[model samples]
Target: MKVICILCDEAFTPSKFQARKIMKHPHKIQICETCHDRITTKVNMQRTAKP
Candidate 1:
């Protein structure tokens, strides 16, 4: 099924199981892999940075 990334607004097709899970859970937000990876990297950097 086709899903739009909430962060980047890019359209992508996820696997059938993922699509169904997203559909079933209204609170879940869909994000493309690229955006997910970007956010993950940023978060990891923040975690490792000394304050």
Candidate 2:
């Protein structure tokens, strides 16, 4: 499946670190290679539950 970053609010390939270490969760967490080591969704866990 294609992944959307849960940090920078943008589309990107997810990080292997967040994908595996964060359990089997496909949401709530995100990672991207082109995000400058940053997440792509630009979402805040304290507010949104999207990924």
Candidate 3:
């Protein structure tokens, strides 16, 4: 199934398991892997920088 990322607005195909989870939970926001990794890296950097 094709899913669109909320952040980048890019469309991507996720695994069947993920698609099912998203379908089951309509309230969950979907984000592409790229955006997810970027956000994770930024948060990690900020956390480590804070002492």
Q: Point out where model 1 deviates above 4 Å.
A: none
1 or 3, which is superior by lDDT?
3
C-alpha lDDT of candidate 3 relative to the true structure: 0.92
lDDT of each: 0.88, 0.55, 0.92
Cα miss at 17, model 2 (Å)? Answer: 9.3
**Per-candidate alpha-carbon RMSD to the true structure:** 1.6, 9.3, 0.9
Q: Over all chains combined, what TM-score does candidate 1 have?
A: 0.80
| Tens-place lDDT digits, model 2, residues 6-37 | 55677764466655755576445554566643
Measured with C-alpha atoms, the lDDT of residue 21 in candidate 1 is 89
- What is residue 35's positional error in candidate 2, in angstroms? 3.8
lDDT, residue 32, model 1: 87
Give Cα distance to truth, residue 6, candidate 2, Å.
1.2
Worst 10-residue lDDT window, candidate 2: 37-46
- Number of colliding residue pairs in each model: 0, 11, 0
Write one digit per residue (lDDT tens) for candidate 1, span 1-51. 788999989899987878888888969888888998999999999999968
- What lDDT tens digits, residue by residue, belong to model 3 across residues 1-51? 899999999999988888899889979999999999999999999999996
Rate residue 25 of model 2 by lDDT: 65
